[model samples]
Target: MGVFLETSRLVLRPFGAGDVDLLVALDGDPAVMRFINGGRPTSREAVEARVLPRLLRDYPWGTRGYWAAEEKGGGGFLGWFEFRPVEAENPAVVELGYRLNRSAWGRGYATEGSRALIHKGFTDLGVERVTANTMAVNTGSRRVMEKSGLTLVRHFTGDWPERIEGSEHGEVEYALTRSRWERTRQPPAAPRP
Candidate 1:
């Protein structure tokens, strides 16, 4: 399998046909699905029919897409990370997202992977902006975004298809522009002649 990115403790790679079971199990966990689908488990049929196909075709314009995150030491599947365009109409701006197993929570895997991808986006991919959104009550994800250098850009309600527990609190969006990201890592190589 081709690796997309790497961190100190994790390796991010593209999903393969063999990853269907893994994806199903990850989305099946209630705790994992709590914030995402109100604790509803994704069915195997759905994973095979819709989800996997969608993820496979997701990356067209950007170098980054949905990647499976595995631990480097034991080579276990931790979760997946997405670094892709926020909208099909806009390729300059990318979105950062992650979904980890409940066992992998609180261990900084999310933040570490996110930080690495953000760095690559700014320094390698020429991405203009990176954005992320989460439920307002998802403090864990918000903390990860903050640690990854994304600042709160907006807070507004969304028209979600399903009613979730924390939907009432609305959602928050975090973003970092290439200019802001570069400033944080200033004093780089000389400008292109």
Candidate 2:
């Protein structure tokens, strides 16, 4: 499969037909799925029927929204990242998301990949804004968003079908705009004499 993006230690590639097992393994971890589904495992049937199809679908902007993340040197499947447009015909605003195996947590992969995607969106993908959301108590994910140059935009209650552990506190949205991002980008260093 063609690589969508690459960082120093990760390779983001398009999902393939043979990646069902990887998805199954990733969603099968209770610790990883805690905030998503109250520690429930996603059935393989659901992965094949719904999850994989959504990942495989191409957006109207001519790109895949989800990418399978892997370690640089054959370290194997870690999980996935999402950088999809909010509107089907407009690439101006996009949402960012990530889900990694328990083994990959605390390794900075989330922040690294998010930063790269934000940079790409702003520079090459005609994106004007990037946004992300997580359960209010998800401090780890919040930190990743902050590290990726996003700021808290709002806190609102989502109408989830089932209440997760932290649902009582609602959810938080973080965002970064192109103008803000450009202002924060480091200027080129002066040439030496």
Candidate 3:
């Protein structure tokens, strides 16, 4: 009984306790979790004890949280998308991210889900900006970020615990401000402001 946002091929909906199975299945896929965990599987206990709790905690801060993305026609769970604020001190901003089953790749679900979330941020959530980050070698995610209208903000290097292959060149952040999003949403430009 939560609200759902529908794109042409996917639907984004609120998370529920019943989603543990879906999370396990998604995290179990070696191909899906390759870059994230070096193909290691995530245990259900870890997801239940730590991941889900942290994911849902953002609800109190803002209208930003993870969502379950499903195929509109079949109702199959593709994966999840996150539109949550990066909880930190001082001014904060929302971040966009997604994780899909291997079957969901090359199907445009990432782009569709991301675009819907970006629009929801600016229009419904009053978010002034949205950003996304991925490993520098993560071309697929970077592509989704750019296709969703975010420009490269910076490249960040972190001491990742897993140390995947692409972690070397560092991670990149992409962002889109409200004004930039508004411009992309418009039909045609009349004149400069």
RMSD of each: 5.5, 4.3, 5.2
lDDT of each: 0.85, 0.90, 0.79
lDDT of model 1 at residue 191? 17
Q: For candidate 2, lDDT tens digit of each residue in 1-193?
A: 4899988888899998899999999999998998898889999999999999999978766889999999988988999999998987788999999999999888888988898888888888999999999999999999989988899999999998998899999999999999999999622222223
* TM-score preference between candidates 1 and 3, better one: 1
| Steric collisions counted per model | 0, 0, 0
Winner on lDDT between 1 and 2 is 2
Candidate 2 lDDT (Cα, 0 to 1):
0.90
Candidate 3 residues 1-193, lDDT tens each? 4656877678777777788888889998888887787888999999898777765554544443888899887779999998887654312378899999888887778887888888877887767889888888889999988878889999889879868776788989999999988877732112123
Ranking of all predicted structures according to lDDT, beginning with the best and ending with the worst: 2, 1, 3
Q: List the residue pairs that clash in candidate 1.
A: none
Relative to the true structure, candidate 1 reaches a TM of 0.91
Question: Which candidate, 2 or 3, has the higher lDDT?
Answer: 2
Off by over 4 Å in 1: 61-64, 186-193
Output the TM-score of candidate 2. 0.94
Candidate 1 structure quality by residue, lDDT tens digits, 1-193: 4777777788888888899999999999999999898999999999999978766765555444788899986689998998888776566799899999999998888888888888887877768999999999999999989888899999999998999999999999999999988788522122123
Please tell me which predicted candidate would have the highest TM-score against the true structure: 2
